[model samples]
Target: MRDVCVIGLGLIGGSLLRAAAASGRTVWGATVSEVDADAASRGGYDVTTDAEAALQRAASADAIVVIAVPLPAVENLLRQVAQHASHCLLTDVVSVKGPMLDAVRRRAPYTRYVGGHPMAGTSRSGWLAGDTMLFRDAAWVVGVEEETDLTAWAEVTRLVLDVGAHAVPLPADSHDETVARISHLPHLFAAILASVGAQGGPLAMSLAAGSFRDGTRVAGSSPDLVRAMTEGNRDALLPIVDDALGRLGAARGSLASTGGLAATINAGHEGALALEATRDAARSGVRIDLTAADAREGLVALGERGGRITGLDGAVALGEVS
Candidate 1:
C-alpha cells in the first residue's frame, strides 16, 4: 500500500497503525475523540479527529482506508470515506461482515470496498490494549463479491499478509454464517457461562478453574461491542443460537442415561482432537518460493487443488496437498 489510513483508533485500529508504521508504510489515523487521536500520535503516527481532512490530505488511488470503528458507526464513516477518498481501497476489521458489506455496497457504490474481519482480538478495548502481534498468524477473512474490485482485493490480501495474517477469501453472507457458528456463538456461550457463574456467588467465583476462566474470558469484552455484533448479525446468529439450544437440550436429556453423558464428553474430545490435527497439518505445510505475482498465482492454483495456504515468506506456502 502506498498510504494507509485507519479510522477509529481503538484496539484493532491502533494495532494496525503500529504494524503499518513498523513496516515503514506512510500511515495515518483518525478518531472521533481527541484523547484517542492523542494516543495514536503518541504511538508514532500522524492522527487527527477530523476524518475527512485526514483522508483528503492522504488522498491517493493507492491508499487503503480501513474502517476500524464499531458496527453502528460504520455506515457514516463509510459514507464520509466514499465522499473524500473515493479512489482508495476500503476495508474494515469489524467482527460482523454481512451488515458491513451491505452498508458499504449501498453507501459507497463508487468506492472499491472489501469487507474484512481479523479473527484475533482480546476482551480488552481501546488503544492501550492494542498489540502489534494481535493479528500475527491469525485468520483474516476478506469478503469478495461480483462487484469487488480485483486490484482492491489484491491490495487487501497484501495488507493481510503484511500484518502477518492468513487471508481467507469468502463471500459476505458465508462469512457471516461461519462466524455466527464459530465466533458469535462462542461469545454468546461465554457471556452465558460468565453470567451463570456470577449467580453462584463469591465461593463459586473464587473456585473457578483454568477451563472456566479461559472459556468465559471473551465475556469480559465491552458490552456495547458484543451487543452491536450480536444484534447486527441477528439474522445469522439466531439460527445458530437455536441449534446450540437444541444441542444443550440433547445433552441435558443424555444426563439421565448411563453412558449418555460420557458419549457427549467423548464427542467433545473427538472434536478437540480433530481441531488439533488440523492445526498441526497447517503448521506442517510445504514451503515454496516464488516472486510476489507468482506467489499470488500459486496460492490460487493450490487453493483450487484443495490445498491450504498456511503462511507467506514473500514466496508463499502452497500448503500440504490434502
Candidate 2:
C-alpha cells in the first residue's frame, strides 16, 4: 500500500510506521497519548490521536491500517476500524492469532483484514523502543482464511517485505499452535525457572551464571504482554505447556535411578545439540528433516563429545550425537 495507518504507537506500531516511511510510503501513527502523537508527527509520521481521523487519512491514500494494540484491545480496535475505516485494508501486529483473527472476522466482516505477528522485539515497550529496523530479517506470520482475497494477501506480503521481514503465511489455527509451542511456552518456562531458582536461597542465585541469565532473559518482559498472549491463546498453549512439564517430569523421574545423573546429562546434551541443529537450519534457510536415524547419530556424537551415555541404545533413543 502507498499509505499506512498504524494504531497504538507502541514499539511495533512506531517501528512499522518508521519503516514504511523509509520505504517512501505515506505513513501515519495513531495513539491515545497526546505526547506520543506529537512525537510521531515530529518524527515524520502523519500523526493523529483520533481513530476517525486516522481512518479518514487512510481512505484517501491506499492505506493498510495496522492495529498494533495488545491482544485484549485488538477486537474493540478492529470494530473501531470497521465502523470508521471501511475502505482501508486491515491487519495487526498482535502476538496471538486465534483471538485476533476471530475478533476481526466477527467485528469487521466486510473489511479485507489479515492477522499478523512480526516475531521480533525487545523487553522494551511503549513509543520509546521504536526502531526502524526492528523487523529486519525476522519472520512475520500472516494468518489468513478461505475468505481472504488474493490481492489483499499479496499486498500484505509486500508490506512485510517493506519492513524487512519475510512473510510466513499460516492459517489462524496453525499460527496459534506454532506460536504456543515456540513463543508462549518459552516465556512461561523462563519465568517459572527464574522464580524457582531465585526462591532456592540467595547463595544459590549468586552462583547462577551465563546459562541461567541467558535462559531467564525473557522473564524481564512486561508481565501484561506475557499474560495477554498466554491467556488469549490458552487453548493451544495449555497443552504445549503441559507436554513440556511432562518431559521435565520424565527427566526428573529418570534422575532417581542408578544411572540417573548420566541419563539427565545425556538428555541435556541431546537438547543442546538439537537446538544447534535448529539454529543451523534457520541460518541456512532450510528446514531440517528429522528422522530416527539422524537423531541416533546426533546422540552418538553427543556421547562421543564427553556426554555420559547411559546405555548402548542411548544414542538411538535420544537421537543426539553432539
Candidate 3:
C-alpha cells in the first residue's frame, strides 16, 4: 500500500489526505496542533504527531510527504523530512515557488523534491473546509529544476492526476512569474479595493454591487497568508504591480483627454471581451500555448482601443492607427 503523509491539516493538505484515502491509499496526516490532528483523524486520516514517526510511515510506504504548511515553515519541514524520509519523495503546495525551490535546493539537496501548486483554493481554511473536488479541473503547476529526478516528478504528476487536476510543467521562475500575474497581483488588487470599499460609509457598502463583491472576493482570505505571498514573492510581484499601475494610469489619462472618453468606453467593452477570452482559453487549454507575440498583440490592441496611444501631436487621439 502506498503511504502518503500530509504535514498540514489546512484546506489544501486536508483535501489531499481525503483524496488519497478515497483512492485506496494508506494516508497519514500530521499537524502541530492536537485539535487539527484529531480533526484529521476523525476525517479518516491515520493521524500522528511525531515528526520522525510520520517520516518513517512516509519512507516505508512509498510515501510522498505533501508539505502543506506555510511558505516560511516549508524549509524546516523539508529539512526534517530529509533527515528521516530519505526514501520518500517530497512535494509542497506553496503558491510561490521560486523561494521555496531555492530553500529546498539549499537545505534538502539530497531529497527527491518536486514543487507543486494546485491552482485551487477558497478563502476558507482548516480540515473541515476540505473537499474531494477542490482540485478538480484545476491547473496544477509542477515546478521542475535541473536536478529533479524523473521518478519523483512522475510520482508527483500521478498525485496531481489522482486528485483530478492536470499537471502543467513549469520552471520555478516561470511558475512564479505566471502566478504573480494571474494570482498574486489579483490578490493585492483585491485587498486594495476592499480596503477602499471599507472606507466608504455604511450606506455605500449597503449599495455595493456584484462587481464590487466579485472584485474583492479574495480580500477575505487570511491576511497573514496574503502578506506572506506579497513579501515572499515581492521580486516577481513588483513588476506585475508596475504593469497594472501603468495600465491604470493610461486609462485615467484617456478618460481625462478631450474626445477620448468614447474610445475609453469602447475599451471597457474590449476589456470584457478579453477577460472572457482568457477564461475560455484557460478552459480550453489554450493559455498553456500563448506566445510573446500573442501577448504583445493583445496589449497593443488594448492600448489602441483604450485611446492611450499618443499620436504625432502628443495627445491621446481617437481613430489613430498605431
Candidate 4:
C-alpha cells in the first residue's frame, strides 16, 4: 500500500489518517492544532503539530500528501507544500474543487495533483470527532481533468478505495456544481430552517420532531467551516439558491391566492421519490481501462451518469453504472 501523509487533521483529515492506517497503509498526519495533535498522538497514531516536518518526511518517503484543510487556508498551506513536497503525489479533501485546483497550480505547480472531496461528514470538527468508518460506502470524488496525470489519479483512487469509500471520477468544475446543490445548499437551508424554528419559541421547540431535527442537523456545524465551503462554492451555489428562492416565491404566491400548498408539497414529494428511485436503481458491472487514451473522459462520463468506481484492478478500474 502507498503511504499517506495528511495535513490539517480535523474531522475529515483525522478520519482519513485513522482509516488509511487501519487499511495497512503507513499513514501519518500533521495538524497545527495542539489539542488535536495531542489527541491523535494519544490514540497511538503518528501525528505531529509540525506540518513542515511532516511534509519534508512525506517528500522523502514518496508519500501521497492529502491536504485536508478548509478552502480559505488552502493557499497558505500550498505554499508550505511547495517548499517541502512540490513533487509529491498530492490530493485534497477540500469541499470545493475548482478553487483548490487553481490554488495548486498557482502555489505548487510541480506537484502531481488531483482534487478530491469525500461526500461524507457530520456537524462535527477536530480530531476527537474523527471516526475511521465515516467514509464507509460514501462517494469520494477523485478529480479527472484534461491535463490530469492518470497514474497519480490511480494512486489517489487506490487510497480512497482502501479506506472503504467508492470513488466518483469527475472534473473539478462539474464536481463544484454538483456539490453546490447537494451539499452547500443543504447547509444553507439547514441554517435557515434552524433559525425559523427557533423564532417559534418554546412551543415550536417542544413540538420539533423528526423532520425538524433532520432538516436542521447540519446547521449545528461550525459556522466557520460552513462559510468556508458554502461561500467558496458560491459561484455555483448562487444560481441554485436563486432557483430555490423562485420556487419559494411561487409557492407563497399560490398560498396567498389559492390558499393551498399542493404544488409545492407535491413537487418536493416527487423529487424525494426520484432521489430514492435513483438510489435503489439496479446497477450493472462495468470496467474502465485506465491505460486507454480517452480514460479520463470515460471516467467523467461514467460519474455523470451515476456510476461509481468500487475498486481498482490494476490499470483497469472495476466499477458499475446504474
Off by over 4 Å in 3: 259-275, 278-322
**Candidate 1 residue spans exceeding 4 A from truth:** 60-62, 257-259, 282-322
- lDDT, candidate 3, 1-322, per-residue tens: 3568888878898898888788777788787768778887776578776667888777777688888888878778877887878657889898888999888878877778889998899998777888988988677776556666645665676777777776666667877887898899989989988889989979769989998999999999888888877788989998999998987887788777753666656777998899787555522112211123343233234322321111111111111121
lDDT of each: 0.79, 0.74, 0.73, 0.94
Best by TM-score, which number? 4
- Separate clash counts for every candidate: 0, 9, 0, 0
Query: Which consecutive 10 residues in model 3 have the weakest lDDT in total?
Result: 309-318
Write the number of the candidate with greater lDDT, choosing between 1 and 4.
4
lDDT tens digits by residue: candidate 4, 134-153: 99999999999988988899
**lDDT (tens digit, per residue) of candidate 2 on 1-322:** 4678898988898899899999888787789888888888777677888977887777777589899888888777777887887767888888888778778778888888877889899888777788999999787776546666545755776788778886665667877887898899989989988998889889969999998998899898899988988899999998998888887777788776553666667877998898788556522122212233343234223323322212122112211222
In candidate 2, which residue pairs get closer than 3 Å at backbone N, Cα or C atoms, i.e. clash?
A: 295-319, 298-320, 298-321, 299-320, 299-321, 300-321, 301-321, 302-321, 302-322
RMSD in order of candidates: 3.6, 10.9, 11.3, 0.8
